[model samples]
Target: MFRATETFATHAVANQPEPADPPDPWADDPALRGRLAAQGGDAQTPAALGAAIRDGDAWALGEAARRHPPELRLWDRAGRRLDEVAFHPAWHALMAMGLEAGYAARPWDGRPGGHVAHAAMVYLLTQAEPGVCCPMTMTYAAVPALRADPALAALWVPRLTAAAYDPALAPVAEKRAATMGMAMTEKQGGSDVRANTTRAERDGEDWRLTGHKWFCSAPMSDGFLTLAQAPGGLTCFVVPRWLPDGTRNAIRLQRLKDKCGNRANASAEIEYERAWAQRLGEEGQGVRTILGMVHHTRLDTAMAPAGLMRAALREALWWCEGRRAFGRRLIDQPLMRRVLADLCLDWEGALALGLRVAAAFDRGEQAFARIGVALAKFLANKRCMTVMAEAMEALGGMGYVEDTPMPMLYREAPLNGIWEGSGNVIVLDVLRTLSRVPEAREALEAEWDAGAGDPPYDAALAAFRDRWPGPPDEGDARLWAAQAAALLTASVLARTAPAPVAEGYARARLADCPPVPGALTGLAEGAILARLGGAGPAGESE
Candidate 1:
């Protein structure tokens, strides 16, 4: 909720508008001139730099930024209407800089990474210019290996990165994103990797992938990172945008997905025809590599919603304080203040959860990787939708109106949860991860003997067993419901375990904390048992 004092007029104080100064010719500001000289921009004219897009190097991208500038673009469609067109054009300019800067090289490429390359990608994403950023990030993620095979990466990086400005490419293809990356998705096999129906067969030295993928984000990208079933195991491959001789491959664009958000970037259904592909990683390692990418993407998805919420709330708060209703400021109303507070609290939770997951990933923690990723995506995305809704309500009709940005963000935020992996899929993955932990099972049993460890979790485990006296049927919805419920209960329990009593006043303070609930404990126990029995709720068992 927002109080009048806390509203934009007060907060707007933090957003002071500065007087525009005449463009500096080159006096000597270290921050500006220093960075420029360091980057070899000291003696160059902005025009001279704009002309350098032909090389698509970092310096050229900087020059492009000086020339083109940046802004956000929101959209409405032919049959279905989108909420708003939102993006910062500067992000696009930065991506062009990335391409020009040659930052699209392989992961292992010797190019220096600092503020420039990273700023380029961050600007695109934060500003909703993922057309260029998504493709570049995907390509960059695989660059270590791509660089190892320079012929392949070298041939495509330039084409993909250069899409932002190429005249012919932008008309039919994604001039902003280029043709370097393709999305991998399936109707039947989103999280259930084993359910993939796409097949790849060997043809002499070449392999062909055949399947239909839904929501290929950048269909115009020169190649798609595809998943297919191999004789030996599940495999991942990169199918080129065109044939060996540079002809269009046998890929049919079924239809562009009229998505709820992120419309600036292409999301289309695609059909493959014996599409030639080169294997990435080993046959059985497809799931591993794909999951690795999914982890990062999940973080990206989480961050997008959080950022959107921040921007939306800021807009709403500004409006509340600045606008008037009933001859008084909206923020003066206690209810509005509460709403604003709730919005901030939601934002904090989502931000904390997303940052925690991202930090874990940054540290390369593989043990709880899946669980952390799912949790972050699950919580952050859900919070984004919640906050957006709250913002919209707080704004009343204005929130829904297109002129204001809140509705656009509210409409677009839900897509994040559904796209990366539906909420259900992510919850299931968390359950699966927890179920597989031997220590988790051991802890459940040990809690009973200790009579003091995470009792709610232990009780939840017991209750689950009481409900299901025998092993579960794979198809039983109760089994999955129980599993997810148990995971949540257990997660809370693990997080809230009572600290050991200290010797004095500290010990007494610890003792005052409530004991863990029994129902949650029983739930954990039953889920562990079911998991240890080489099974899970229906549709997930081996």
Candidate 2:
């Protein structure tokens, strides 16, 4: 005797879909290898490393990132001042992985395409765990600033490039690896480092710095690059945590910031009372010396949004592919396909744009790079926030909670836009270059013209170039930035991507190509899907 609803059976626990160990995302991504090849880098290392991240310890590391955000330990047990930050063992593991993969110092590899290779590697690694990239990126960017004082660079470079992870706070000689941090911002000047109030003075041929830095990132590092006012003018200084005599410096940690995201790395407020420092560059030349490092950081910051979007897109697509609703897979629906395709366009375009800027660095074409980095940073970071939102929506209720990676991705979305420089600052940088720098427009126009294969592209390029070569004002900076980004992205896509991708980009983005979602309209059942599609659904396994 059984009812229609129940036939002598009891309920069982429902097993939701979850993401498994992914295969080598790098080997399958021809685009990354292709980009690397253009720069003369060997893709074997990156491909192999990509497989390791996917098939190896990414999940465990990600759990550590989630379970144990960094903890700041300010004092030792015996009432001595330690001023240290303690991270989960997982953070160190992630850092070791990043360093071992050569993402940290590959730009200085003395190869033909080191910067490009480094950029591609960084772009991929950030997808797995973005929090640890902070310390590593700062360390990577610090090389140029150190190069200003070659003697100082000679002292620090070898220690920094070591792949081993040595977390114990001790003398550099005792550590297997070293990292660097920065402290330019104060409560007063955010992006305006020129307004810094920290003072540096000559102390028996050794410099002593005295002031407060409002945001000191990765405070556990062996050294820091800071800015202060000296007798001559604004000067850059290198402040080590330990003196040459192995004594602690006068630096004191105030408190760590409660940031909205990036929880795994410590951002501290520090006070310096005659803290020991060595001059980095000529007096009154702080900006000129530090600008190189800042430029490199901006390039990396621009890539973060793209990496984050890719992470989100993968998670969303995975959920859609496996879950069923309305009698079929959610991905089979027309609206969902349009959304995924739109997401794909943005993600791929962003990746292409980021790699293009990185290539500019490899080529050392400073003029082209100046304008290109600005446009890419402003445009890509802004779109990254929106793309993450759309991705979360595609995942529906699962995306709204802590059970999936979508929420984490969403929280970190706005960071790239705000870091290094905000949207307004970046746009102003672009305009300043166009208005003041000679040959700036010329270089940009050349990049724009490279995309013109038909009347529509030409017309768009004309529209873009027409807005330039005139008086610059902040009122129209966003419009100018958008057009510049679109033109540059289209130029790159037309040059590198396949015909269908170019066609899809043109039809969806440029409004030039004929509407043909008819065949391109499939719910991701092709090579493009394989490239941008996801693994299994995302959730923690029991």
Candidate 3:
């Protein structure tokens, strides 16, 4: 006992930061509150959900789910074919909570600001756990795609929009609720979905599909909206997990993808050996039909990066406020203040622009929504990697460790950028929208005009027009997208953000700010940092 006591005494912990407590995501974030209100969304649902997440130990659940990834159970003990994925209990719990809170069902509830509210929920749920969001997002987005077939929509839409969660393996009609998935990409085509090789043949009133899917997201869903080639060219179809006769479909799971991130969710490689399916849209309209789902999913992809940035920054700020270097807190250092203040601009701009796009969706501004979402997704995701890296660096060695959340956030940063569309795809889409749709250009100009009074923004807009009187060369599409997106973000911030925040963004991002982080000349650091509201260690101001 004496020897053990003497050995342990020398290894006492000292000056280590306490674990970051789970704060109310809705209550603690003034930016979220302001943006939600400005977008005409009520806070009651978000507030309640945020509190429930915090109180229900969602932080621990998220950690557990990621630490213990889902497992693919290909066969049962009896050796029968079973293409089922088994998830950790934590994953199931989070899914249940999200579905109950209307993560997938809110926008279809016939309430005002339904889409705006759905966007807010996306932002909030992403902070707690980004992995479990895949199924919920697909389920939410599938409502629109399903509408292409009124009969199918009538059968599936209610189950998809029901405020309940059912993970049973029965027919969708037999379950209390249902979730939807998507299987679009194949080996030959990533974004060039028009080149898909899947074959669909008419079988009586329904159809049968026979092809392989390279990436099938959320493979355990009750049904999937998939694409295949028909006699009339590519077409969209609804492939169920179970046939209407109550037996498993002929869909075979090849293997789950070993991804760099999003471990808690399952992405699969699968083959459809004459799998029964229902046509979702008319033949040869697959691209146009599935785009309805793609459009809405892009909104979540835009908002998720903001949520990730917010989560990482909160952790970094908490660590800095609690730990000290050279007899003063790390947050009190000049360099640290500049770094954090610089990071805050991206978060604020992203939040503002995303919610603004959601408001457009609510108001049925299709032209603006089409172009605005691409800009928001491209810019926000690009900034997310930088913010996540810097925030992790702020914590030094501890941030790299799994004990903290930085590693997960860093892994997840690039996912949204790659999902729905990569950077190049998004840039091309932006150019296409401007070139083909006159209303898209007008909508963009109208948005820029809303915040035209700012001197820096005005100069930038003039330069942008002069630089590209017509669309730039295809090689310069990325440059065009980046500058245009930044300008659009500045415009939105000028109208929605606080005075100092907006002014700083316009001066730094729009004018002469360098490409590097923490390279700043003049910014209201105190006011900028104040937006990340919380008390420091020992009740000190952050």
Per-candidate TM-scores read: 0.60, 0.89, 0.93
Instruction: Tell me the tens digit of each residue's lDDT in model 3 across 1-542.
Output: 12222225568655677655678898899999988898898677677778878887788898899889988898999999999999999999999888888888888888778778888888888888998999999999999999999999998999999988999999988988999999999999989999999999999999999999999999999999999999999999999999877999998999999999998899999999999999998899999899999999999999999999999999999999989999899999999999999999999989999999988988889999999999899889989999999999999999999888899999999999999999888888988988899899889888988889889889998998888777767667777777777888888888888988998888878875224233342555555666788333454443
* lDDT of model 3, residue 123: 85
- Residue-level lDDT of model 1, residues 300-416, one tens digit each, is 565556556765776677777776777778888888987776566444334433443443443444544345556556655665776788888877776888655565566677776
Off by over 4 Å in 3: 1-8, 512-542
Q: In candidate 1, which residue ranges exceed 4 Å CA deviation?
A: 1-124, 127-137, 140-182, 437-542
**Comparing candidate 1 with candidate 3, which one achieves the higher TM-score?**
3
Which candidate leads in TM-score? 3
Question: Candidate 1, after superposition: displacement of residue 231 in Å?
Answer: 2.4
Show model 2 residue runs off by greater than 4 Å: 1-18, 38-40, 511-542
**What 10-residue stretch in candidate 2 is worst by lDDT?**
513-522
**Model 1 lDDT, residue 433, Cα:** 62
CA lDDT of each candidate?
0.51, 0.79, 0.89
